[model samples]
Structures are given as structure tokens and as C-alpha cells.
Target: MSHPTADRARQLLDLHTQPEILVLPNVWDVVSAQVVAATPGVHALATASHSIASTFGYPDGERIPLDLHLDMVRRIVQAVSLPVSMDMESGYGHPGDTARRAIEIGVVGGNLEDGMRPLGEAVAAVQAVMDAGRAAGVDFVLNARTDAALRADPQAPRSSVIEEVITRGRAFLDAGAPVVFVPGLVARDEIQEVSDAFGPRKLTLISVPGASLPARELQALGVSRLSTGPFTQRVALTALQDAAAEIVAGGTLPAGTRPLN
Candidate 1:
């Protein structure tokens, strides 16, 4: 199998001819990465940080150490032939440390979020990370995430949500982030509004099972990219549970469920 090259990732980002948004199914491991890469038109692979952390018996909130996370990135990169982007939650440290380690492991892209930092400080962190990538000769696609909706109360005003995301997104872009990811955005009109507000700027929309609109529909609204973001991992876990329950209930294995070697 072919391995992902830096040039391939750069080419993927340079294509801005259409309103067609790239759908990136989040993968937790080498097997999932290979499965997603086998699907047609899946030009890139994105790592779900939550999924990765959970697999290692850790929670999603920066629980996994940086060395282990980079090791996982290296393994996934070796396993798949498509460009791999990682969900580098809060950069796992200060911006420079995270970005340097990410590029060192051959990750072509990653997401950094403005979690607890002030907006300006977050931008500066991201800028340091981008500089680290450039110094390593990797053209990293940094998709900065603004987590206002996830943190704020559900009853928060829509205007407050919009204002925070736009403010953070602008700073990230100015600091060299190629794309801005807004998680927890659900409504079609809201997605369109964000897309319109960031015209010519790349925007990444994340989908949760019931919280967000469908991926194809979001693409139609001009989103630059779509990610499942730990949803697929949950689906896999649910399936395993159901299968185990069936066995415990004296149900026989379905025919052709196992392959012959």
C-alpha cells in the first residue's frame, strides 16, 4: 500500500474549485483507518482524539500523554495510504510542543481548540504550532476549533455563540490555521450563516448523531470538510455490546459472519 506524502496533503488542501466538502470519517485505530480509506472518495483520514484516548483506557480531556498520542499517529500513518489529520485536543500542551511532535510523527493535519485560554493567547499558541510544522518542512493543515457551544449553557443566546466562534476563528486563521472547526453546530441556517460569515475561509463542520445536520446536507451549505468526531467509535462499541448480548441469549452466530482463511 502507498503511504501518505506531504505533497498529497498539500494537493488535497489546494483544491478549492467546488462547493463539495470533503467528508472525513474519524478512525480510532489502524483497522478503522484502513476500513475508512477503502471507501471511495475518502481522500483523507482524521483521527478522533476521544476515540484514541478511550482505546487506551483514558478519558478525552487531555488524559493521554503526548508521546503515546504521537505513537498512535505514527502507527495510523503507517497503516493507511491516505493523508491523515489528527484531532489534537487543546494541542495536548502549549502550541509549539504539540505541533512539533505532530509533524515529527508525519501527521499532515490536526485540530487545535481554544479551550480555556483567552482568544488572543489561543491564536498565539496556534501560531507557534504552525511555525513548528513549517520548520519541520511539513505543510500542516491546522483546523482550529472554538468550543463555545460545548462549554456554554444550552440557554445561552445564539448571538453569544456566534460572536465567540467568529472571534476565535478569525484569530486562528490570522495565526495560520487553514481551517476552523466549529463543533456542536446543528441547524442548517446556522451552518449556512457560519459558512457565509467565513466566506473564502475554510470551515470544518462536525456531526453528532442527533445534534447536527447530515454530512451531505452540510456540504451543500458550503462546509469545507465534515468529521464524525468519536460517533463512529460509539457505533462500534454499541455493535460489540449487542453482539455479545446475542451470544449470551443463546443466539447462534450469523452465517458468513466469519471469513475463511
Candidate 2:
């Protein structure tokens, strides 16, 4: 049976191929989602799992229960008119079950990372997601993350790290993930090398402090998608802390606060 949201899946995938890089602000809750959705002409919305877990008093990884995570994603979907993608970290078991849960929640696509798993294991997980999608007649977008660039030993040779990421990226594409996401490879040459190596295959880069390339420049370097993981959430939390401190000192409430339905 085809998933009810199969059409949305294709639409989300098309956005990535467009000339403009698909930039997802990566919200964690209904309020953050509403703020982005309210902006005129926003393309889509994506949830940052790390932010969601932290808000729920848990750390990253699958620290939050599957049901709870799905519930939050569902709420985000209900709150936004744009397509929403869940950051399904290592997935909540196998890739098929993860795909099932994500598609069931009305999300069009998701980010599936390798985490600490072996390369082959990660590739298998991506294939499992693809298999599930086929059985269900769905075409979900799998943004595969290879952590070798981010998690490998710093003393390792740059050539080896780049090769590992490239190799895993090739495997991920073979496994049916349309986009390869390699966070922490913010250097310009490294990003270019991956882009050149993959040729037509799309690359997703994380937007972080001290990124050697800007968003548009990354686009020029062949990056198809750019997302800020949990940086925005951290900024918000810091702002909230400052506001609370003022409130405790008898200062009036901040002016831009709005109520949500």
C-alpha cells in the first residue's frame, strides 16, 4: 500500500534539486515551527532531534522514547503547512521501522546518520529504509550522514578521512539515499572534493560557526541542502535565560512574545 503522503515525498525531493539551496532552520517544537511557517514564502520545515530531546529533558541519541519523539514530530506537522522532515538519528531500531514511523507521522523525509555504527551497518540501515519504502510504495528522501569526517581521529590523514567519507557516501547512494550529509567538513577544499567526487549526487552540509563557505558559496560548491542543527535552539535557550533574569529583577516582559493556539 502506498503511504498517504507519497506525493509529498517527491515534492520535497524536488526542492533539493532546485538552484537555490534548501535551507532548513531546524526547529524543535510547535512554537519554533509556527515562527518559521508564519514567514512568507518559506519553502519547508525540519525538526532538529537534538533540540527536541534537550527540550524534553533528554540528551541526543534516542534518549527520548519513540512514541514521544513521534508525537512531537506529529505536532510539528500539524502546525506547519510546509513539508516537515524528521531528523531520525540512527533510527529507533531498524531503518524500515524508522521509515514506517516517520512516514506514518506525515513527514515527507528525514536525516539518517551513521552515528557510531560500522560503515556496513549504516549502509544496511539505509537499504532497509529503501526496502520499506518500496514495500509501502513510498518515495521518501533519505539524507544519509557519514560521520567519518566529523568523528574520525583528528590525527588521521586528511586523505584517509576524505576517502572514508567519499566511500561511505558512495555506499549510501547505492543504498538509495538521495543526499549525503557530512557535517564538520566545513573546509572549502574538503567540501569541494566531496562535491567533485560525487558529481551529480547531492551533498548536504551543516551550517555552523566558522564555516569556511557561506550558504550561497556552498551552493556554488554543489551543496544541495544546508541545515543548522541545534544552533538555533541553543540561541533561543540563551535568550530565554536572559529574559528570565530580567523578569526576576522586576523588568517588564519582552515585547515580541506572542501566544500560540
Give candidate 1 misplaced runs (Cα > 4 Å): 1-4, 15-18, 254-261
Candidate 2 lDDT score at position 93: 78
Best by lDDT: 2
Off by over 4 Å in 2: 1-4, 247-261
lDDT of 2 by residue, 1-261 (tens): 554478778788888899888888889999999998787756888889999999899999899987898899999998777888899998887767987878877887888889858878998999988787676667888888889898989899999999999999988988888898999889889899999887653899888866547888898888989888998898788788989999999997789876744
TM-score of each: 0.92, 0.92
Q: Note the residue pairs that clash in candidate 2.
A: none
lDDT of each: 0.80, 0.85
**What is the Cα-based lDDT of residue 257 in candidate 2?**
78
Tens-place lDDT per residue, model 1, 120-192, is 7898888887888778766778888888756767788987888777777777877888888888778787778
Q: Assess candidate 1 and give its TM-score to the true structure.
A: 0.92
In model 2, what lDDT does residue 124 have? 93
What lDDT is reached at residue 97 by model 2? 91
- How many residue pairs in model 2 have overlapping backbones? 0
